[model samples]
Target: MVSCYSSHGMVRQSWDLFSSMRRSGFPGDGFTFSALLGARASSSCSDHAKLLLLLGISVHGLVIRLGLHLDVVVATALLDMYAKCGRVAEASRVFDAMVLRNTISWNAIIVCYGQHGGGKEAFELFVCMMRDGCCPDELTLSSLLSSCADMAAANEATQLHAYIVKIGFQDFLQVGNALIMAYGRNGFVQEATQMFGMIPNPDLVTWSSMVSSFAYLGLAKSAVHLFDRMLQQGIQPDGVAFLGVLSACSHAGLIEDGFKYILLMMRDYKMDPTPQHLSCLVDLLGRSGRIKDAYDFVVNMPFEADVDVIGAFLGACRMRGNIESAKWAASKLFSLKPNDPVNYLLISNTYAAAGAWSELAKVRSVMRNMCGNKVPGCSWIEIGGIVQTFVSNDMILHQSREMQKMMDLVSLVERYCNDDDIICNDPSLV
Candidate 1:
């Protein structure tokens, strides 16, 4: 009964049966505990993670008392439970204490670190796994590539690609898809396109990655071209693929194409628009100076308008100096995300741009009292194989002598250009 409940994902029922088993003096064995632990680990609700971790720890105690912790199956289950529950430290301890390990054990721990934003550590573990005579398979490479993508470790990703080619795993669809995403995330659009071409039979994920790569680089025509090619190849697009095309249209201000894709997704593919798709459409119309249309679309959306939708409308209103629409959007946004400083910032900027000083003052006062300090904008750039992040008002970076030299050089160039007729003063020519 316990196993059945756990298998079917009735976590509460599984726990209840587990307690009942203990009360009935039926001390569970390794298999029973594994089932319970697996159920807890795979619980869908993120808010239940802490509770699941506590329950898993109690089960771990029982496994130790019963001497089942030494069982490989039981140990692997425990390791996976700890890792999935965000207890990376505890998972590491379990991994280190294991007298015997398998590929599953190694993959679990590597993925644990990878999923928790420990990309560097996960790569180190991959190195350690190789040293211990455990040859990495497709899963290992894919996990490491995913971590590299998340961290934007392009240099490491390139090395992994070479490794994949050497190991003959490059032909595997999963590894191919991972490589595409990794290259795309690190701004290697050409390499991503190459990877996409290399795939003998590209799936939806592969097509989506290529389209997204083009979209990310602001090459909307190329992105749309790829989408058309994908359709010609008889590969159906999923929501993600639509998202990439829609995003390309939004960035390029191709409002008609955006609407056409939305209608096609609904009528042809029979796919309901996801929040991301809807957000892209809103952005498309908003960016094309159709603020009223975007506002109407948001108001008529089947689902409640989310932050992204409202933010898009508000941004368009700000650009067009539509004070009335901005106020309405700002009210909706405030109710949805009261603590978001961007919401307050956008509304205040709109009022200021429209020369509504009283409204601007009121918005500023509310922002000061409610939202506190505005978050500084930040950007990252990779140089010399390292990612360097800079934030607005960062005195440390600003004070750097190297930066000062660059600024001085820029000023000198500007003065020289202004003194001569070599540089055109017209905005379009410059």
Candidate 2:
């Protein structure tokens, strides 16, 4: 009954049954505790992780008391639970203490690090897994590739791709999809295209990844063309695929085509417009200089406008110099994301652009009082297979002195250009 309840995702009921069993002098085994832990992890409540972690810890205590801590299955479940709760360190500790390990154990810990942006650590663990004679399967490679994508480690991803091909896992659907995503995210568009081509029978995920890759690379026509090909091939389009198409249209400013696709999605495909779809529509219209229409669209959206939708509208307002609309959108954004500094920054910039000095000052004052220091804008670039990140006013880089000198030179050039405008009348000189 507890297993049934847990399987059905009735977390509270499962817990109740578990308590009742214990009260009735039924000492459950590892399987029972594992079921309860799985149910706890699957709970969809708002406070999911916090509540799930508490239950997981309790179950872990019970496992230790029952001398089942070394059981592979139970230990794996504990590792997964900790990882899901963002307690990667605790998960690592559990992983290290396990007397017996399996591929599942390694995969769990590697995935934990991968999902949490510890790509380097995940890579190290993969190497250790190889040394420990634990042959990695597709899941292991896919997880590591995903981490590479997150870190924009193109070189690492390429090496992994070579390794996957050598191991004959290149044709595997999941690995192919992960490779496509990793290559695309790392700016290896050609490699992503090749990966897509290598998949003989592409699924919806494959097609979606390829289309999104093109869209992200600003090749909107290619993205749209691929979507058409996908349709012609009789593969059904899901919300994600539609999002790629819509994003492509937005980026390319194909307003009419975007609307047609939206209508097609609704009328023919029976797909409702999600917030992401609405955001793309807003961006499309706004970028095409139809700010009023974009605002109206947001106002009349069937679903409540989320932060992304409002942010899109706010961005449009900023572009079109609609101070009133921008102000209203910023307020909505503030309510939705009170702690987000971008909202305050956008509003302040909009006010400044409109010469509303008093309003700009007020916004700045509010930001200073409520949000404290604004986070510096940061960006990263990959050179020689190493990704280096830089932040505005950063002082931690190894070549900070050289960077400062470059910045000083650029500032000087800007000041000089602004103060004195020299013109050459000779055509040859021009």
Candidate 3:
């Protein structure tokens, strides 16, 4: 009953069942804790997630009291639950508390950091995983490569690629696909294409990754060509494949091609368009400067327009300074993401673009009151073989430390350029 209720997200029922089990004198074990912890992680959004997080904390207390915290399986489940709850620090604590960990344990922690843009943390954990002699699986490499892509750490990606080749994990399709994407995202599309060529019996993901690489480079013709080649080989295109092609078309202003693939995905492949597909369509329509058509398409879609679609519409409106369309899109965006400062900023930016200073000021005032804490943007620098990454919040969190780092950077520059002979009076310096 606990598993059933938890799996279906019946939070109250799951807890009631657990209470009944305890009353029935059936001792809780790792499986019981795992199931209950999973229920916490299953929470979707809004107040319910908060409620689950509180309940999950209670469960953690119970686990500690019962001495089940030392159980490797239970500890792993707890760590995973904390990670899923967006409590990275707590998750790290749980991981550090564990005496024995397996591959899945390392993976859970690595993935938690990776998903939250903690690329430096994830990489450090990967190094620890290797130092501890726990062999990494394909998913591990894939997750790390994904972090590399997100960070645009070209040097890191190249080094990871070399390590994969050394460990003979290059043949793993997941790793291969991730490497292609990482290389492409880092502006090494030719290397990505070469990697694609080297893959023996490439699967659907390999082909899709290659297509996306081309699409990202605005090589729409090449993307479409490779997509067609995949079809010719009798591999049915999935939603991702269709999304890649649609994105390619959108990037290149090939609205006809975009519509063609979207229709083909739904009609020929009998697959429903995902949110990403719709967002790409919005982009395609917006790129063509058909604002009304795009707005109408979004309104008339089977599902309501999500943040991405509305945001895309707003972006197009900004380009044209279409205040009315921007307002309309902003209204929908605000409803979809009420507390997201990005939405407020987007609308405010659109208003500024339209020279609606009064409206922009109004939005900014509202943002200051309702959303004081926005997601922090991150930046990084490589110095002396060390990658120092920081986020916007760090200024307030560690202003002195950050200032010191900046001063050190200035000092390093002075060491190289303080004399002014190398850079002074050089004609190219101008």
Candidate 4:
């Protein structure tokens, strides 16, 4: 029966067959559970993991009833299922309740925590695992490094780097790539570059990481240079690598280079540019005041333009104070996203700019008829993971007094300084 399940497929069918043909002679064994768990945990079937979780619970109840030990394979699978389900709390409970914990067990829990944005918790677990005297492995280090990257934990990242070097895992390519990502994300480009140089034979992941790091640092020239070098090394650039290169070109306003890379990606690499790539191109042209060209590009695009693509064009028009173009782009954008209050506000703003008070009134009336509640345009900046959001007039709790005091201060400051050009703060003039 197991042979039949194995021949058909590796996972679900085997379990069904095994349950149906409950041979009295066949005793439940670890190998069978391991194989079944492997099949369930394999990628591409997220639903299977959920089913496995339910089955695992039933198996656990049976084990408890019979006073049987929970096998390591079943334990790991249960942990993985909970983790993948975005139920880290349950996963942790399962992990702690397990009778035996191995390297795989620890690795699963740490990775789950990291992916779920519990970076600080993951780090604490890593330290505790080390204190427990469990020999640190690459999988453990990789998971911890990913957590550090996600949180942009520079100090923790530096310590992890030292630990990796001390453990002699720095030579491993996978570990090196993870470290590169951690350093790159934490704004340590020089350190990331130094690490990249030490990699004897870099793979696609290594090259992609370096390319992304260069792009993130706004060093598009360097990104393009490294891309050329990668091609010379016969390393094929994947979608992510191309995205990094294109983004670099966009950042530096290198239009020609941007077009060249787009052509290379499509013709040379035989890879079609995604919507994001096209949007980047439109944004590059738009921000450079080539609003007409950007508009033409969108109209000529092989696929339908998405909200993002249209928004890029509209923003460019607003930047250039091209009222005609702004109105055109705004019309299309509003049509695409009527439910969005911000789009209505943008159109009204454009109409106000053009001195079309009646059109502005018309827009506001439509908004009122549709939904009287207006979601104001708010801006936010994150400082130390705390987001400070500001709207037109509404103040945060206990901050109104301070806000009033600041307004009085601003009035005093304005009386002493008069500059018409400096009077406005909208960088996008339109």
- On lDDT, the leading prediction is 2
134 Cα displacement, candidate 1 (Å): 3.5
lDDT of 1: 0.89
Candidate order, lDDT descending: 2, 1, 3, 4
TM-score of each: 0.82, 0.89, 0.80, 0.70
lDDT of 4 at 79: 78
Worst 10 residues of 3 by lDDT: 391-400
What is the per-residue lDDT of model 3 for residues 1-430, given as tens digits with 9 covering 90 to 100?
7989989988789999999999999878888988899888877676777788888899999999999999888888888888888999999999999999999999999999998989889999999999999999998999999988888788888889999999999998889899999998878988999899988888999999999889988899999999999999998888888988999998888988889888889889999897789989988888889988888998999987788888888887887778998888888888888888998988898888778899999999988888996776678765554566787546544455878789897886676576587667555544
Off by over 4 Å in 4: 1-41, 44-69, 305-430
Where does candidate 4 have its weakest 10-residue lDDT segment? 35-44
Q: Model-by-model lDDT, in order?
A: 0.89, 0.90, 0.87, 0.79
Candidate 4: clashing pairs of residues: none
RMSD of each: 5.2, 4.7, 5.6, 7.8
lDDT tens readout by residue for model 1, 18-127:
89989999999988998998998788688887888889999999899999999878888999999988889999999998888888889999999999988889989998
Q: Model 1 Cα displacement at 373 (Å)?
A: 5.0
Q: Give the runs in model 3 whose Cα sits over 4 Å from its true position.
A: 1-21, 31-59, 356-359, 373-430
lDDT of 4 by residue, 29-123 (tens): 65555445444444336656667667656655554454443766677776775686677998898788888778888888899999998887887
- Between prediction 2 and prediction 4, the one with superior TM-score is 2
TM-score of 2: 0.89
On TM-score, the stronger of 3 and 4 is: 3
Clashes per prediction? Answer: 0, 0, 0, 0
Clashing pairs in 1: none
